[model samples]
Target: MDAGLKLRGIVAGYGQGDILRGLDLDVPAGQITCLIGPNGSGKSTVLRVISGLLAPRAGQVRLAGRNVTGWSPWAMLDGGVAHVPQERSLFPAMSVWDNVLMGAYINADRDAVARRATDIAQRFPLVARRRRDLAGSLSGGEQKTVEIARSMMLDPPVLCFDEPSIGLEPRARRTIFGILAELRRDGRTVLLVEQNARSGLAVADNGAVLDAGIVRLAAPASQLLDSPDVGRLYLGAS
Candidate 1:
Protein backbone atom coordinates (compact mmCIF):
# COMPACT_ATOMS: atom_id res chain seq x y z
CA MET A 1 0.00 0.00 0.00
CA ASP A 2 1.14 3.50 -0.75
CA ALA A 3 2.24 5.68 2.15
CA GLY A 4 -0.67 7.76 3.38
CA LEU A 5 1.42 10.93 3.67
CA LYS A 6 4.54 11.72 1.61
CA LEU A 7 6.84 14.70 1.65
CA ARG A 8 9.57 15.02 -0.98
CA GLY A 9 12.34 17.61 -0.95
CA ILE A 10 10.16 20.00 1.02
CA VAL A 11 11.47 23.41 1.92
CA ALA A 12 9.37 25.45 4.34
CA GLY A 13 9.99 28.22 6.82
CA TYR A 14 8.47 31.17 8.59
CA GLY A 15 10.35 33.99 6.89
CA GLN A 16 13.74 34.50 5.24
CA GLY A 17 15.29 31.60 7.14
CA ASP A 18 14.20 28.13 6.13
CA ILE A 19 13.56 25.55 8.86
CA LEU A 20 12.97 22.47 6.73
CA ARG A 21 15.27 22.01 3.75
CA GLY A 22 15.07 19.11 1.34
CA LEU A 23 13.11 17.11 3.91
CA ASP A 24 11.69 13.85 2.64
CA LEU A 25 9.54 11.34 4.49
CA ASP A 26 6.76 8.78 4.02
CA VAL A 27 4.22 7.86 6.71
CA PRO A 28 2.90 4.38 6.02
CA ALA A 29 -0.80 3.67 6.18
CA GLY A 30 -2.40 2.08 9.27
CA GLN A 31 0.65 2.89 11.40
CA ILE A 32 2.03 5.51 13.70
CA THR A 33 5.22 7.28 12.57
CA CYS A 34 6.92 9.22 15.36
CA LEU A 35 9.20 12.18 14.62
CA ILE A 36 11.90 12.95 17.20
CA GLY A 37 14.57 15.59 17.10
CA PRO A 38 16.35 18.27 19.09
CA ASN A 39 14.81 21.67 19.85
CA GLY A 40 15.49 23.36 16.49
CA SER A 41 15.35 20.48 14.05
CA GLY A 42 12.03 21.58 12.57
CA LYS A 43 9.94 18.77 14.00
CA SER A 44 6.84 20.93 14.35
CA THR A 45 7.56 22.58 11.01
CA VAL A 46 7.03 19.26 9.26
CA LEU A 47 3.50 19.05 10.66
CA ARG A 48 2.85 22.66 9.72
CA VAL A 49 3.92 22.10 6.12
CA ILE A 50 1.87 18.96 5.78
CA SER A 51 -1.25 20.50 7.35
CA GLY A 52 -1.08 23.60 5.13
CA LEU A 53 -0.32 26.04 7.99
CA LEU A 54 2.78 26.87 5.98
CA ALA A 55 3.41 26.35 2.26
CA PRO A 56 6.65 24.85 1.06
CA ARG A 57 9.01 26.80 -1.16
CA ALA A 58 9.65 23.65 -3.21
CA GLY A 59 8.87 19.93 -3.44
CA GLN A 60 5.58 18.14 -3.08
CA VAL A 61 3.30 16.71 -0.40
CA ARG A 62 1.24 13.75 -1.49
CA LEU A 63 -1.64 12.14 0.39
CA ALA A 64 -2.92 8.81 -0.89
CA GLY A 65 -1.14 9.44 -4.24
CA ARG A 66 -2.45 12.94 -4.78
CA ASN A 67 -0.30 16.07 -4.58
CA VAL A 68 -1.68 18.41 -1.91
CA THR A 69 1.20 20.85 -1.49
CA GLY A 70 0.28 24.47 -0.97
CA TRP A 71 -3.22 23.55 0.03
CA SER A 72 -4.88 25.69 2.68
CA PRO A 73 -5.39 24.38 6.24
CA TRP A 74 -9.12 24.12 5.70
CA ALA A 75 -8.58 22.41 2.34
CA MET A 76 -6.24 19.90 3.94
CA LEU A 77 -8.79 19.17 6.67
CA ASP A 78 -11.45 18.61 4.01
CA GLY A 79 -9.06 16.34 2.13
CA GLY A 80 -8.86 13.84 5.01
CA VAL A 81 -5.75 15.26 6.69
CA ALA A 82 -6.60 16.58 10.16
CA HIS A 83 -3.98 18.35 12.27
CA VAL A 84 -4.09 18.71 16.05
CA PRO A 85 -1.43 21.30 16.71
CA GLN A 86 0.96 21.43 19.68
CA GLU A 87 -0.99 24.09 21.53
CA ARG A 88 -4.17 23.52 23.52
CA SER A 89 -7.05 23.80 21.06
CA LEU A 90 -10.47 23.88 22.68
CA PHE A 91 -13.28 26.27 23.39
CA PRO A 92 -13.07 26.94 27.11
CA ALA A 93 -16.71 27.88 27.58
CA MET A 94 -18.16 25.12 25.41
CA SER A 95 -19.48 21.80 26.69
CA VAL A 96 -17.48 18.65 25.96
CA TRP A 97 -20.13 17.33 23.60
CA ASP A 98 -20.41 20.70 21.92
CA ASN A 99 -16.66 20.94 21.52
CA VAL A 100 -16.55 17.62 19.72
CA LEU A 101 -19.45 18.64 17.54
CA MET A 102 -17.60 21.84 16.64
CA GLY A 103 -15.24 19.70 14.63
CA ALA A 104 -18.06 18.92 12.21
CA TYR A 105 -18.79 22.59 11.66
CA ILE A 106 -17.93 22.46 7.99
CA ASN A 107 -20.55 19.85 7.25
CA ALA A 108 -24.00 21.09 6.28
CA ASP A 109 -26.03 17.96 7.01
CA ARG A 110 -27.46 18.25 10.49
CA ASP A 111 -28.57 14.65 10.68
CA ALA A 112 -25.22 13.36 9.49
CA VAL A 113 -23.39 15.55 12.02
CA ALA A 114 -25.58 14.27 14.82
CA ARG A 115 -24.98 10.69 13.72
CA ARG A 116 -21.25 11.17 13.61
CA ALA A 117 -21.27 12.90 17.00
CA THR A 118 -23.12 9.94 18.47
CA ASP A 119 -20.56 7.52 17.10
CA ILE A 120 -17.64 9.64 18.33
CA ALA A 121 -19.17 10.02 21.76
CA GLN A 122 -19.48 6.28 22.01
CA ARG A 123 -15.86 5.78 20.99
CA PHE A 124 -14.62 8.41 23.45
CA PRO A 125 -16.59 8.02 26.64
CA LEU A 126 -14.93 11.10 28.06
CA VAL A 127 -17.19 13.13 25.82
CA ALA A 128 -20.25 11.65 27.48
CA ARG A 129 -18.65 11.64 30.94
CA ARG A 130 -18.23 15.37 30.70
CA ARG A 131 -21.06 16.01 28.26
CA ARG A 132 -22.57 18.93 30.08
CA ASP A 133 -19.39 20.22 31.74
CA LEU A 134 -17.44 23.17 30.38
CA ALA A 135 -14.26 22.32 28.50
CA GLY A 136 -12.12 24.66 30.58
CA SER A 137 -13.25 22.99 33.76
CA LEU A 138 -11.65 19.66 32.79
CA SER A 139 -8.13 18.70 33.77
CA GLY A 140 -5.28 18.84 31.26
CA GLY A 141 -5.50 15.14 30.57
CA GLU A 142 -9.26 15.27 30.21
CA GLN A 143 -8.94 18.25 27.88
CA LYS A 144 -6.46 16.35 25.74
CA THR A 145 -8.87 13.44 25.55
CA VAL A 146 -11.60 15.77 24.39
CA GLU A 147 -9.21 17.20 21.79
CA ILE A 148 -8.56 13.76 20.35
CA ALA A 149 -12.28 13.04 20.29
CA ARG A 150 -12.89 16.33 18.51
CA SER A 151 -10.24 15.61 15.90
CA MET A 152 -12.01 12.35 15.05
CA MET A 153 -15.19 14.21 14.40
CA LEU A 154 -13.94 14.61 10.85
CA ASP A 155 -13.26 10.89 10.48
CA PRO A 156 -10.17 11.70 8.43
CA PRO A 157 -7.87 9.00 7.11
CA VAL A 158 -4.67 10.72 8.23
CA LEU A 159 -4.08 12.47 11.58
CA CYS A 160 -1.18 14.77 12.38
CA PHE A 161 -0.47 15.28 16.07
CA ASP A 162 2.20 17.66 17.33
CA GLU A 163 3.34 16.59 20.79
CA PRO A 164 0.09 15.00 21.88
CA SER A 165 1.69 14.06 25.18
CA ILE A 166 3.21 17.36 26.08
CA GLY A 167 2.48 19.03 29.43
CA LEU A 168 0.97 16.00 31.11
CA GLU A 169 1.75 13.53 33.88
CA PRO A 170 3.17 10.07 33.16
CA ARG A 171 -0.29 8.57 33.38
CA ALA A 172 -1.72 11.12 30.98
CA ARG A 173 1.19 10.60 28.64
CA ARG A 174 0.51 6.89 28.74
CA THR A 175 -3.10 7.54 27.89
CA ILE A 176 -2.09 9.59 24.86
CA PHE A 177 0.19 6.83 23.67
CA GLY A 178 -2.58 4.33 24.19
CA ILE A 179 -4.80 6.48 22.04
CA LEU A 180 -2.17 6.51 19.31
CA ALA A 181 -1.95 2.75 19.44
CA GLU A 182 -5.72 2.49 19.14
CA LEU A 183 -5.65 4.85 16.17
CA ARG A 184 -3.20 2.58 14.35
CA ARG A 185 -5.44 -0.43 15.04
CA ASP A 186 -8.30 1.49 13.44
CA GLY A 187 -6.21 1.90 10.26
CA ARG A 188 -5.53 5.59 10.56
CA THR A 189 -2.18 7.00 9.42
CA VAL A 190 -0.58 9.05 12.19
CA LEU A 191 2.30 11.52 11.98
CA LEU A 192 3.37 12.39 15.49
CA VAL A 193 6.04 14.81 16.74
CA GLU A 194 6.85 13.89 20.29
CA GLN A 195 9.47 15.18 22.69
CA ASN A 196 9.43 12.12 24.95
CA ALA A 197 11.47 9.98 22.59
CA ARG A 198 11.43 6.79 24.67
CA SER A 199 7.69 6.52 25.20
CA GLY A 200 6.95 7.88 21.73
CA LEU A 201 9.02 5.25 19.95
CA ALA A 202 7.64 2.54 22.21
CA VAL A 203 4.17 3.02 20.71
CA ALA A 204 5.21 3.96 17.18
CA ASP A 205 5.43 1.47 14.32
CA ASN A 206 8.18 3.55 12.64
CA GLY A 207 10.48 6.31 13.76
CA ALA A 208 12.26 9.14 11.97
CA VAL A 209 15.16 11.13 13.37
CA LEU A 210 15.29 14.73 12.21
CA ASP A 211 18.37 16.88 12.58
CA ALA A 212 19.27 20.30 11.30
CA GLY A 213 16.21 20.54 9.09
CA ILE A 214 16.57 17.10 7.46
CA VAL A 215 15.80 13.49 8.19
CA ARG A 216 18.96 11.84 9.42
CA LEU A 217 17.50 8.39 9.82
CA ALA A 218 14.26 6.48 9.33
CA ALA A 219 13.72 2.94 10.53
CA PRO A 220 11.53 0.57 12.49
CA ALA A 221 10.77 1.90 15.96
CA SER A 222 12.28 -1.09 17.74
CA GLN A 223 15.46 -0.93 15.72
CA LEU A 224 15.90 2.74 16.39
CA LEU A 225 15.22 2.27 20.09
CA ASP A 226 17.81 -0.50 20.32
CA SER A 227 20.51 1.48 18.57
CA PRO A 228 23.12 2.61 21.08
CA ASP A 229 24.07 5.65 19.06
CA VAL A 230 20.47 6.73 18.56
CA GLY A 231 19.76 6.19 22.24
CA ARG A 232 22.82 8.10 23.32
CA LEU A 233 22.29 11.04 21.04
CA TYR A 234 18.54 11.46 20.78
CA LEU A 235 16.70 8.84 22.81
CA GLY A 236 18.51 10.00 25.99
CA ALA A 237 20.54 6.86 26.75
CA SER A 238 19.14 3.34 26.96
Candidate 2:
Protein backbone atom coordinates (compact mmCIF):
# COMPACT_ATOMS: atom_id res chain seq x y z
CA MET A 1 0.00 0.00 0.00
CA ASP A 2 3.01 2.25 0.12
CA ALA A 3 3.09 4.62 -2.84
CA GLY A 4 5.58 7.41 -3.40
CA LEU A 5 3.90 8.90 -6.48
CA LYS A 6 4.54 12.61 -6.16
CA LEU A 7 3.51 15.61 -8.22
CA ARG A 8 5.30 18.91 -7.78
CA GLY A 9 4.64 22.00 -9.83
CA ILE A 10 2.80 19.97 -12.43
CA VAL A 11 1.41 21.86 -15.43
CA ALA A 12 -0.86 19.89 -17.76
CA GLY A 13 -3.81 20.38 -20.11
CA TYR A 14 -5.20 19.28 -23.44
CA GLY A 15 -5.03 21.41 -26.61
CA GLN A 16 -5.88 25.00 -25.71
CA GLY A 17 -5.45 25.86 -22.04
CA ASP A 18 -3.85 24.37 -18.93
CA ILE A 19 -6.12 22.52 -16.52
CA LEU A 20 -3.53 21.89 -13.82
CA ARG A 21 -1.19 24.77 -13.09
CA GLY A 22 1.68 23.98 -10.79
CA LEU A 23 -0.43 21.57 -8.76
CA ASP A 24 1.21 19.74 -5.89
CA LEU A 25 -0.06 16.84 -3.82
CA ASP A 26 0.81 13.39 -2.47
CA VAL A 27 -1.43 10.31 -2.22
CA PRO A 28 -0.89 9.01 1.32
CA ALA A 29 0.60 5.54 1.42
CA GLY A 30 -1.61 2.78 2.82
CA GLN A 31 -4.55 5.14 3.25
CA ILE A 32 -7.70 6.20 1.44
CA THR A 33 -7.20 9.66 -0.06
CA CYS A 34 -10.15 11.26 -1.86
CA LEU A 35 -9.82 14.13 -4.29
CA ILE A 36 -12.89 16.38 -4.61
CA GLY A 37 -13.65 19.38 -6.74
CA PRO A 38 -16.18 20.91 -9.12
CA ASN A 39 -16.23 20.01 -12.77
CA GLY A 40 -12.97 20.83 -14.59
CA SER A 41 -10.98 21.42 -11.43
CA GLY A 42 -8.23 19.10 -12.64
CA LYS A 43 -9.31 16.20 -10.45
CA SER A 44 -8.94 13.66 -13.26
CA THR A 45 -5.63 15.17 -14.25
CA VAL A 46 -4.11 14.13 -10.95
CA LEU A 47 -5.01 10.50 -11.60
CA ARG A 48 -3.60 10.69 -15.09
CA VAL A 49 -0.33 12.09 -13.79
CA ILE A 50 0.01 9.29 -11.26
CA SER A 51 -0.87 6.61 -13.81
CA GLY A 52 1.66 8.05 -16.28
CA LEU A 53 -1.13 8.76 -18.79
CA LEU A 54 -0.07 12.39 -19.00
CA ALA A 55 3.37 13.96 -18.90
CA PRO A 56 3.85 17.07 -16.83
CA ARG A 57 5.38 20.09 -18.48
CA ALA A 58 7.23 20.53 -15.18
CA GLY A 59 7.78 18.74 -11.85
CA GLN A 60 8.28 15.12 -10.90
CA VAL A 61 6.36 11.93 -10.03
CA ARG A 62 8.21 9.65 -7.67
CA LEU A 63 7.17 6.12 -6.73
CA ALA A 64 8.64 4.44 -3.64
CA GLY A 65 11.07 7.35 -3.66
CA ARG A 66 11.99 6.96 -7.33
CA ASN A 67 11.46 9.73 -9.91
CA VAL A 68 8.94 8.58 -12.52
CA THR A 69 7.48 11.83 -13.79
CA GLY A 70 6.87 10.76 -17.37
CA TRP A 71 6.82 7.00 -17.35
CA SER A 72 4.50 5.26 -19.85
CA PRO A 73 1.26 3.47 -18.90
CA TRP A 74 2.92 0.04 -18.91
CA ALA A 75 5.82 1.39 -16.86
CA MET A 76 3.46 2.75 -14.23
CA LEU A 77 1.61 -0.57 -13.97
CA ASP A 78 4.92 -2.39 -13.64
CA GLY A 79 5.76 0.00 -10.80
CA GLY A 80 2.62 -0.82 -8.74
CA VAL A 81 0.39 2.04 -9.94
CA ALA A 82 -2.96 0.88 -11.33
CA HIS A 83 -5.41 3.44 -12.70
CA VAL A 84 -9.16 2.73 -13.19
CA PRO A 85 -10.24 5.35 -15.66
CA GLN A 86 -13.61 7.15 -15.53
CA GLU A 87 -14.89 5.64 -18.74
CA ARG A 88 -16.18 2.08 -19.10
CA SER A 89 -12.80 0.41 -19.27
CA LEU A 90 -14.01 -3.15 -19.46
CA PHE A 91 -14.39 -5.14 -22.64
CA PRO A 92 -18.12 -5.33 -23.37
CA ALA A 93 -17.72 -8.17 -25.85
CA MET A 94 -15.66 -10.30 -23.47
CA SER A 95 -16.87 -12.45 -20.61
CA VAL A 96 -16.44 -11.23 -17.05
CA TRP A 97 -13.69 -13.79 -16.48
CA ASP A 98 -11.88 -12.73 -19.60
CA ASN A 99 -11.99 -9.05 -18.67
CA VAL A 100 -10.44 -9.79 -15.33
CA LEU A 101 -7.78 -11.88 -16.98
CA MET A 102 -6.85 -8.92 -19.16
CA GLY A 103 -5.67 -7.08 -16.08
CA ALA A 104 -2.60 -9.33 -15.91
CA TYR A 105 -1.46 -9.28 -19.53
CA ILE A 106 1.95 -8.06 -18.47
CA ASN A 107 2.36 -11.00 -16.13
CA ALA A 108 3.61 -14.14 -17.86
CA ASP A 109 2.42 -16.76 -15.41
CA ARG A 110 -0.82 -18.37 -16.60
CA ASP A 111 -1.40 -19.88 -13.18
CA ALA A 112 -0.93 -16.52 -11.52
CA VAL A 113 -3.74 -14.95 -13.56
CA ALA A 114 -5.94 -17.94 -12.85
CA ARG A 115 -5.22 -17.71 -9.16
CA ARG A 116 -5.98 -13.98 -9.15
CA ALA A 117 -9.31 -14.58 -10.93
CA THR A 118 -10.38 -17.00 -8.24
CA ASP A 119 -9.59 -14.46 -5.58
CA ILE A 120 -11.39 -11.73 -7.53
CA ALA A 121 -14.43 -13.91 -7.95
CA GLN A 122 -14.53 -14.45 -4.23
CA ARG A 123 -14.06 -10.80 -3.38
CA PHE A 124 -16.81 -9.57 -5.76
CA PRO A 125 -20.18 -11.28 -5.88
CA LEU A 126 -20.86 -10.01 -9.39
CA VAL A 127 -17.77 -11.69 -10.75
CA ALA A 128 -18.61 -14.91 -9.02
CA ARG A 129 -22.25 -14.98 -10.13
CA ARG A 130 -21.65 -13.79 -13.68
CA ARG A 131 -18.26 -15.11 -14.56
CA ARG A 132 -19.55 -16.44 -17.86
CA ASP A 133 -21.83 -13.47 -18.68
CA LEU A 134 -20.81 -10.78 -21.13
CA ALA A 135 -19.35 -7.81 -19.27
CA GLY A 136 -21.50 -5.35 -21.23
CA SER A 137 -24.68 -7.09 -20.17
CA LEU A 138 -24.28 -6.03 -16.57
CA SER A 139 -25.81 -2.90 -15.03
CA GLY A 140 -23.89 0.29 -14.36
CA GLY A 141 -23.08 -0.53 -10.77
CA GLU A 142 -22.20 -4.09 -11.63
CA GLN A 143 -19.83 -2.87 -14.32
CA LYS A 144 -18.09 -0.56 -11.86
CA THR A 145 -17.65 -3.39 -9.42
CA VAL A 146 -16.24 -5.55 -12.18
CA GLU A 147 -13.86 -2.73 -13.11
CA ILE A 148 -12.66 -2.57 -9.52
CA ALA A 149 -12.37 -6.34 -9.29
CA ARG A 150 -10.43 -6.36 -12.52
CA SER A 151 -8.02 -3.80 -11.11
CA MET A 152 -7.27 -6.18 -8.24
CA MET A 153 -6.23 -8.84 -10.70
CA LEU A 154 -2.80 -7.22 -10.45
CA ASP A 155 -2.96 -6.72 -6.70
CA PRO A 156 -1.61 -3.19 -7.10
CA PRO A 157 -0.33 -1.44 -3.99
CA VAL A 158 -1.58 2.01 -4.98
CA LEU A 159 -4.78 2.10 -6.99
CA CYS A 160 -6.24 5.32 -8.36
CA PHE A 161 -9.91 5.66 -9.30
CA ASP A 162 -11.32 8.46 -11.42
CA GLU A 163 -14.96 9.17 -10.57
CA PRO A 164 -15.69 5.57 -9.67
CA SER A 165 -19.22 6.69 -8.81
CA ILE A 166 -19.94 8.36 -12.08
CA GLY A 167 -23.28 6.96 -13.21
CA LEU A 168 -25.40 4.91 -10.86
CA GLU A 169 -28.48 4.97 -8.69
CA PRO A 170 -28.18 5.93 -5.02
CA ARG A 171 -28.30 2.31 -3.91
CA ALA A 172 -25.68 1.22 -6.39
CA ARG A 173 -23.40 4.07 -5.40
CA ARG A 174 -23.53 2.97 -1.79
CA THR A 175 -22.49 -0.54 -2.70
CA ILE A 176 -19.50 0.69 -4.75
CA PHE A 177 -18.35 2.97 -1.96
CA GLY A 178 -18.78 0.14 0.50
CA ILE A 179 -16.33 -1.93 -1.51
CA LEU A 180 -13.81 0.93 -1.45
CA ALA A 181 -14.16 1.32 2.30
CA GLU A 182 -13.41 -2.37 2.72
CA LEU A 183 -10.34 -2.01 0.55
CA ARG A 184 -9.05 0.81 2.76
CA ARG A 185 -9.64 -1.32 5.83
CA ASP A 186 -7.29 -3.88 4.29
CA GLY A 187 -4.43 -1.31 4.35
CA ARG A 188 -4.46 -0.58 0.63
CA THR A 189 -3.67 2.92 -0.60
CA VAL A 190 -6.68 4.20 -2.59
CA LEU A 191 -6.66 7.47 -4.51
CA LEU A 192 -10.26 8.30 -5.44
CA VAL A 193 -11.44 11.20 -7.62
CA GLU A 194 -15.11 11.71 -7.09
CA GLN A 195 -17.52 14.58 -7.74
CA ASN A 196 -19.92 13.42 -5.05
CA ALA A 197 -18.11 15.16 -2.21
CA ARG A 198 -20.43 14.17 0.63
CA SER A 199 -20.35 10.43 -0.04
CA GLY A 200 -16.79 10.35 -1.28
CA LEU A 201 -15.41 12.05 1.83
CA ALA A 202 -17.48 9.83 4.05
CA VAL A 203 -15.32 6.83 3.07
CA ALA A 204 -12.02 8.68 2.83
CA ASP A 205 -9.48 8.96 5.59
CA ASN A 206 -8.18 12.21 4.16
CA GLY A 207 -9.67 14.59 1.61
CA ALA A 208 -7.93 17.08 -0.63
CA VAL A 209 -9.95 19.95 -2.11
CA LEU A 210 -8.69 20.84 -5.53
CA ASP A 211 -9.68 24.15 -7.14
CA ALA A 212 -8.65 25.57 -10.47
CA GLY A 213 -5.92 22.97 -10.76
CA ILE A 214 -4.50 23.54 -7.29
CA VAL A 215 -4.78 22.19 -3.78
CA ARG A 216 -6.93 24.69 -1.94
CA LEU A 217 -7.35 22.62 1.19
CA ALA A 218 -6.31 19.30 2.70
CA ALA A 219 -7.82 17.89 5.87
CA PRO A 220 -9.09 14.81 7.62
CA ALA A 221 -12.42 13.71 6.14
CA SER A 222 -14.36 14.24 9.35
CA GLN A 223 -12.96 17.69 9.89
CA LEU A 224 -13.54 18.75 6.32
CA LEU A 225 -17.10 17.47 6.37
CA ASP A 226 -17.85 19.80 9.21
CA SER A 227 -16.07 22.80 7.77
CA PRO A 228 -18.62 25.50 6.98
CA ASP A 229 -16.70 26.53 3.90
CA VAL A 230 -16.60 23.01 2.54
CA GLY A 231 -20.30 22.55 3.15
CA ARG A 232 -21.21 25.74 1.38
CA LEU A 233 -18.82 25.52 -1.54
CA TYR A 234 -18.41 21.80 -1.95
CA LEU A 235 -21.45 20.09 -0.52
CA GLY A 236 -23.91 22.91 -1.28
CA ALA A 237 -25.44 22.28 2.10
CA SER A 238 -26.20 25.88 2.85
The candidate that achieves the highest TM-score relative to the unseen native structure: 1
Q: Considering every candidate listed, which one attains the maximal lDDT?
A: 1
The alpha-carbon lDDT assigned to residue 126 of candidate 2 equals 85
Stretches off by above 4 angstroms in model 2 are: none
RMSD of 1: 1.1
Model 1 agreement with the true structure over 7-53: per-residue lDDT tens digits: 99999898799999899998998899999999999999999999999
- Per-model TM-score on C-alpha atoms: 0.98, 0.96
Model 1 misplaced regions, further than 4 Å: 1-3
lDDT, candidates in the order shown: 0.92, 0.89
Q: Give residue 139's error in model 2 in angstroms.
A: 0.5
